[model samples]
Target: MLETGQVISAENGQAQVHFKRTSACERCGACGMLANGQDMIVTLENTIEARPGDQVVVQMQTQGMLQASAIAYVIPLLLLIAGAVLGKLALAPLFAGVESDVVAAISGIALCALGFLGIHLLEPRLRRQKRFQLQMVSVHRAAQGREEEQIDKE
Candidate 1:
C-alpha cells in the first residue's frame, strides 16, 4: 500500500513520521521490521504533505510487497520475451535465405527495445511508492546535547 505522510522531525539520517497504515501494510517487509517497537530507518521516497509537527495521512496500498515486486519484475520480462518471440517469427519469412546470426540480431534488437520500454515505464512508479518508519527524530525546539548553542552566547 502507498501512504502519504508528514515528517514530524529529522535527525541522524532519519525522520520520524506519524503515518497511517492500511491493512495491506500488515504484509509489508518494513512493517515486520517495525513490529517490536524498535526504531527503523526507512528511505522516504515521496510525500504528498510534509512539515515539522504536521498531521499527514499516508496512502497505503493493500498489495504485499513481494507480490508487488513480482508483478513489477515479471511483467517486463514477459514483455521482452514476447518481443523476442514475435520478432523472430516476423523476421523468419523475410530472412528465410539469410544467415541465422542476422535473424538473431534482428530479434535481439526488438527484444532490447521492448525491455527498455518496460523499464522506462515501471521503474519510476515503483520507486515513488516507497515509504518507511522513522527511527529517530533529530530536530528539537530545545537543545539537549552540547551541540545546542546557548541563546545567550550569541
Candidate 2:
C-alpha cells in the first residue's frame, strides 16, 4: 500500500514519517495508534534520501501486510477455540466441581493471552525481516497557495 507523509526525521538510511490516519489505516490498526487517534508515525527505509520536513510517498509490500494481519487476528482466535475445546473435553474432567463451560472460558482466555505474549516476543525478529519493511519511494514538493490558485485558474 502507498502512503503519503512528511519526513519527521532521517538518519542511518531510515526515516520517521508523519502521516494523517487514512481510511486504510482506520480499517487496519497494525501500526498501532497515537494519542488523538488521527495521526500516525511510520519508520521506514529512506530509499529516496528523504530528509526531515520533506513530503514523500512510501510503499509497504502487500504480503507483509497480509502476514501481519493474519498473525494479529487469526492465531489468537484459533488458539482460543482450541483451548476451549481442549478444556471442555479434557481439563474440566480433571478439575473436580468445575463446570465444563467455566473451564472452557478460562482456558480460552488464558491461551489467547499466551498467544498475544508470543506475538510480542516475536515482534523484533519479524520487524528485522525485509519483507515486512516499508520503503520511501519519492519526495515531493509541498504545494504552494499560488500553485493551487494557478491550477484552479486553468
Candidate 3:
C-alpha cells in the first residue's frame, strides 16, 4: 500500500511518520484501532534523509500484506475447524460419558486460543524480516502547500 505522511520526528536513519487513516486503511484492518482515527504514526527507516515535518510517501509490499492478512485471519480459522473435528472424532470417543458437541466446542476454543498465541510468538520474527518492512519512498519539500490545502478542507 502507498500512503502520504508527515515526519513527526527523525533520529539516526529512522523517522516516525504520522499518517491520517485513509479509506484503504479502514478496509485492510491491519493496524486495528490504531488506524481507526486520524492519528496513525509509524517509525520507518529514513533512507531518503527526510527530516522532521517533511511530507513523505510510504510504500509497503502488497505480497507481504496479503501474507500477513492470511496469517492473521485464515490460520486460526483452519485450526479451529481442525480442533473441533479432532475433538468430535477422537477425543469424544476417549471420554465415554461426555457429549461430543460439548467436547468439540471446548477443543475448538482451546485450539483457537493456541492459534492466537502462535501468532503472538511469530510476530517478532516476522517484524525482523525485510520483506515485511515498510519503506519511505520519497520526501516532499513542498508539503506546506498541501498541508494548507488539507487544513482548509478540514
Answer with 2 or 3, whichever has the higher lDDT: 2
lDDT tens readout by residue for model 2, 37-128: 99988877777777776788777799998998899899999999999998999899999898889999999999999999999999899989
lDDT over C-alpha atoms for residue 97 of model 1: 83
All candidates: TM-score: 0.38, 0.86, 0.84
> In model 2, what are the clashing residue pairs, if there are any?
none
Query: Candidate 3, residues 14-64: lDDT per residue as tens digits?
Result: 898888888777655454345447668788888887878878888879998
Clashing pairs in 3: none
The local lDDT score (0 to 100) that residue 143 gets in candidate 2 is 55
Q: CA lDDT of each candidate?
A: 0.48, 0.82, 0.81
Give the candidate number with the greatest TM-score: 2
- In model 2, what lDDT does residue 9 have? 93
Q: Write the per-residue lDDT of candidate 1 for residues 94-134, one digit (tens) a residue.
A: 77788655675667667767776876677566555533222
Best by lDDT: 2
